[model samples]
Target: MGRYFRRKLLIYGVTFVIAVSINFAVPRLMPGDPVARMLSRNKVANPESSEAMRAYFDNVFGFDVPLWQQYLNYWAALFKGDLGVSVYAFPASVSSVIAGALPYTLALLLPAILLSWIVGNSLGAMAARNKWLDNGVLPVGYVFTAVPYMWLAILLAWVAGVILGWFPVAGGYSFALTPTFSWVFIVDLVHHWFLPFLSLFIVALGGWAIGMRNLVIYELESDYANYLQALGAPRRLVRRYAFRNAMLPQITGLAVALGMVVGGALVTEVVFAYPGLGSLLLSAINNQDFFLLQGILLFIVIGVLVFNFLADVVYVLVDPRTRLGLEGGQS
Candidate 1:
């Protein structure tokens, strides 16, 4: 077990290194000068003196800093947890910018994700039990999954917020309500959170429903299920037997999905103007906030890595055959 864990750790370390390196390279390799974009809003160039303006442009866009030096500086700052200052959102550290916006996304998304899994899984179990339910739900689930989330958000916003006037159209809250920690603030916050949460649920629930449905359907066809049927097992026992076993495979996907909560949905956030990590990322990129972009990417990479590893560990726990296979492969 120790050796297995050590091997997993080593692999994760290597993957993390590669992911960070790639993250740095992508922004650096882009055509336009990121530094210039970063400074464009802040630096006002006077056209009166072409020479002075030219010099300013050169200083911002034509710097000949060695790639190695820039890479070294980036790594050093990352280690120190200083992702540099953003030129776009003046004087705000990339870390601070992300920290400020993360909670709103989490508050809305975390609940939606949890509910999707629970409700979807239950619905799937029901569908698996009743063929009529499976026939009814699967097509609807697939149709929703096929539709783009941004479009769904738009539709929902129009129907629920515009025509019905049940939800807020945009932003995290009503402008009238100050964000105090009082009951009034809390009530307003929940009221505001409803639309984003609804958007997230509409987008996420379809996939969960389909995935759980497929897993349950496949489990129902297994030999164990047949044997249980022959033995006249109670309905609950049959369901428990099939679901418990089939859930092992589905667990890995669910774990990885949960891990991606930090990444946020860029299109959905943009459509709703939701103050989440996804919106932060879009703003950072538009303004060429390199440090902020890199920080968010690193956070995402680390999250995916940790979650994937946890999934593997869960795989081992759920299916002893997996550990046996790993042992045999190692030998």
Candidate 2:
């Protein structure tokens, strides 16, 4: 077990280093100069002033240094939790910019992924046994899963939010409400949050249901299930055992789904004009804010790695094969 953990830890450590290297290289590889991008967004008229301004910006952003030194400085700042200043939201630290956007994304994504998994799995497990449900759910699930998330979000926004006038189509909250702890502000926040959340929920639901349905059916036909039935176990008991074993893979699927959920939520946020990491990422890209982009991507990498680690732990607890492999030192 200790060796298993050590191997996992070493692999994760290597992954982290590679992720950081890629994060740093990505912005530098982007076309156009960050300094020029920043300058273009300003109104400096004089060529001499512009030149001087550009030189100063270059030095401040460490573009004046050799590439090796700049890379070294980047690592130094990273260790100190300094992600540098944002070129887009100038003078703001990358941490603060990301901080402001992170919560909205967490709120939008976490629930959407979890709820969809729970509901989808339940429906799928049911469909596997019930022919009537299979006929109804399979087709609808296919259709729902087939729709692109952004288009579904737009359709929801137009139908429920625009035409029906039941909800706000955009933003995290109403413009008039100051972000207070009062009931009115909280209600307003939920009103705006629902459409995007629902869009994500509906889209993710179909795939889980379909996968769970197929897995459950397969597990029911497996040798263990046949043995249970041959031993004269009740139908309910056999079905319960089959569903429990089938869910092992479904749990792994949920972990994989989480990695996609973050990006999906961000895209949905952009569609809804919600002030979240997705919108922040767009701002970082448009202005070539390398530090900010690096910070955001780093956050995502960390989140995915952490969730994967947790999934490994959960798998070990639930799946006997995983623990046996660990004991055998299967690396």
Model 2 Cα shift for residue 212 (angstroms)? 0.7
Tell me, by lDDT, which candidate is best: 2
Q: Could you estimate the TM-score for every candidate?
A: 0.87, 0.95
Model 2, 1-331: lDDT tens digits are: 7777778889999999898988889899999898887787787889999999999999888999988898899989989989998888888888899999888888888898999999999999999999999999899999989999889988999999889999998899999889989999999988898998899999989989998999899999999999989999999998998898889888887777776545787678888999888889988888888988998998888888877878888988988888988877755
The segments of candidate 1 whose C-alpha lies over 4 angstroms from its true place after superposition are: 46-64, 227-238, 262-264, 323-331
Candidate 1 lDDT score relative to the true structure: 0.76
What number of backbone clashes does candidate 1 have, counting pairs of residues 3 or more apart or in separate chains?
0
lDDT by residue (16-131, candidate 1, tens digit) is 88989898887666566554564454465655554465455444432446778777777887789877666557567778888888788779777988787777777777787788
**What CA RMSD would candidate 1 show?**
3.3
